[model samples]
Target: MQPTMEFLTSEEAIQVDAALLSSKEKFSTRLAIYALRCLKQIAAEKEISVEAVTAQQVSDWIKKDENIQQQLELDSNFELFFTRLVLSSLKPLKQIAQSEQQPIENLTLKQVVSWFEQESKIRQE
Candidate 1:
């Protein structure tokens, strides 16, 4: 298993938001929510704090290949579905985040909070 993160950066959250293709602002807000949930999952499984997520951890989570169609008795491959979604949605953020070369946990809290604050202002406008 890979190490996990405690939080999502603003850019990463945006990437997830874009991936969802949501039409409603409320739906788009789920990006941060889902990321935190994923971080919690990773933290629980790995016994790590959610604050120290790594690129590798996020990558590993995204690559899990859930295959939920098999679960629901459908003939479709949910694993492939998620794989494509991660590639299309996260690749750009992954690239950009890594280019900075700073620690993942280092910039996460303030940035995520700031992103939310900015969004809140926009929503209130």
Candidate 2:
């Protein structure tokens, strides 16, 4: 029989965020946000607090010292998935910029999202 996974509570999840924030890895703000989103999803599935999965832990498992080429080789789908997530997350930010009458080129949010999309496409090949 398979063992059931144990879940952490909400309080525990907050701890995870702290751990992630303390990691040496210099995750881009958007990447960090994506990681947090993934952590929350994982936590929900496991019925645990998001805190149980620290940023450091995620950094260790997924981000630390890993080359993009290596990651693409490991999972061809990763680039696509990451790009989609980034683009989706950026939509609202883009809308906000537009609403504020800000120039899209000057918007960090738009630039980052465009960068992710372009990088993803290049990596996928």
Candidate 3:
């Protein structure tokens, strides 16, 4: 059976902590690692983290508009995958920010991008 969101969230949190601890040597790479870790949490909940989604899956979700396709092409699949993951997680993060009277924009996008890029590199290595 698939794991619940609670389980996945906890796992992702652990992954993030590990990435942060090991990131002392490489700041950007560490951020990308943590971001990808967060994305994995969303992907796990969405049932897509187990395997890379096929082109057909992408086709089904994305618009047919040439402009949209062009924009999406700017990022590699690895990047886009984590982008989706982070975007998905943003909803709850936004809620928390609002509840705490903080700005959602204050959230660390650079760190997420960095963690995503780093994790992708590690996987490729």
Candidate 4:
């Protein structure tokens, strides 16, 4: 079964050491990555990173993209799949966190996106 959104802000998971909420955070990060990539392409075309790529750019992009947001937030089985993938990778993630002396939530956007990119590459291979 698909994951329900209730646990995102539910009071229950607060009692456990659960961390699947990060799956939701990753979705936001993916959207930001999409926005950043689009901005970078525009910057490349202009031969300058002169123009400011504001939060408005990303927010507007997402605001107009109801379908994609809907799909990522509510549709398909991706959340379940992503959560399982994360659960399976917990040991390595913890190791990275411990070695770095930080929590998983402190991982930068680039780091998290790199992990996602690695997963994509593995699937393609």
Candidate 5:
């Protein structure tokens, strides 16, 4: 699987404040940011591109994280559910990275939040 990734950077947290997302969108953006970090780490360690990282790799990485390990001890279901949540986020993160022609780790919070906002509008249409 992937590796441990920070949920938010100080700069990202600040940008999130400027985005004016709904609660659910905010949650998704945060998760996507975390996923990008995981993907970057996995790609670097595996000597591959970020888009080449597999879901299984990410799942394994999550399982190894100390925080996730603690949660796993308390509930097997949390591991499965959280793993899925993180895996689900990879698609959009990759898309944004691809569209921006940049490495996943280089994507800024403004870019991510703006992409989600555009997507929300598209879905509404």
Candidate 6:
């Protein structure tokens, strides 16, 4: 289920659109941004760092989230798809944040795109 997620605020969307990334990269950037926010919230609630948030914790949080629960009621498949998407997107952002020694939310679009490019080249090797 590719439900449209309004993860970014209007200002954030404008900033992302102004970046020089391609359409696909922009999508990834948005996912990373959203994942970062989720991570931040989870971390705060758990009293841990964003980098320390576990996949299990994220899944539990998503399941318990009121909005997500409402969506799940409307569509059974949303939880699986959205949970996977958020988890997969979080992978690169987590890596980038660790490599850069910054919080995930502090990562820039350029940093994320660069990480993806590196991963792509590595996969081709």
Q: Which stretches of candidate 3 lie over 4 Å from their true place?
A: 1-76, 106-125
lDDT of 5 by residue, 13-114 (tens): 677657767778878988887777777788889999876777788778888776577667777787678777877887888788788998776887778989
TM-score for all predictions? 0.38, 0.32, 0.26, 0.29, 0.76, 0.69
Stretches of candidate 4 exceeding 4 Å from the true structure: 1-21, 54-125
Clashes of 4: 0
Tens-digit per-residue lDDT, 45-119, candidate 3: 567631354434433344332334544565556445634653554444444345556544344534443344454
What C-alpha lDDT values do all the predictions have? 0.47, 0.44, 0.44, 0.43, 0.78, 0.75
Per-candidate alpha-carbon RMSD to the true structure: 10.3, 16.4, 15.2, 15.0, 4.8, 4.3
- Candidate 6 accuracy as lDDT: 0.75
TM-score computed on alpha carbons, candidate 3: 0.26
Q: What is the lDDT of residue 91 in candidate 2?
A: 48
- Taking the tens digit of each residue's C-alpha lDDT, what string does model 4 give over 1-125? 64333312233223221323255545543443333344444445555441343444433443344344554566456544433433434444444446567755454444545555454466557
Weakest lDDT window of 10 consecutive positions for candidate 5: 1-10
lDDT of 1 at 101: 56
| Candidate 2 residue lDDT tens string, 5-72 | 22333443344334423232213434534443555455566666544544444433343323344655
Which candidate has the highest TM-score of all? Answer: 5
Model 2 weakest lDDT span, ten residues long: 20-29
- lDDT of candidate 1 over 1-125, digit per residue (tens): 52343234566556545542334543433444445556656767887765565556755785562533233244345445543443342332233235445533233433444444455566667
Q: How do the residues 1-125 of candidate 6 rate in per-residue lDDT, one tens digit apiece?
A: 55564668786677777766667877887778777778888988998877788778887878876657667788887877877887887678878988989888677756765676566567657
Best by lDDT: 5
Could you tally the backbone clashes for each prediction?
6, 8, 6, 0, 7, 0
- Positional deviation of 4 in candidate 2, in angstroms? 30
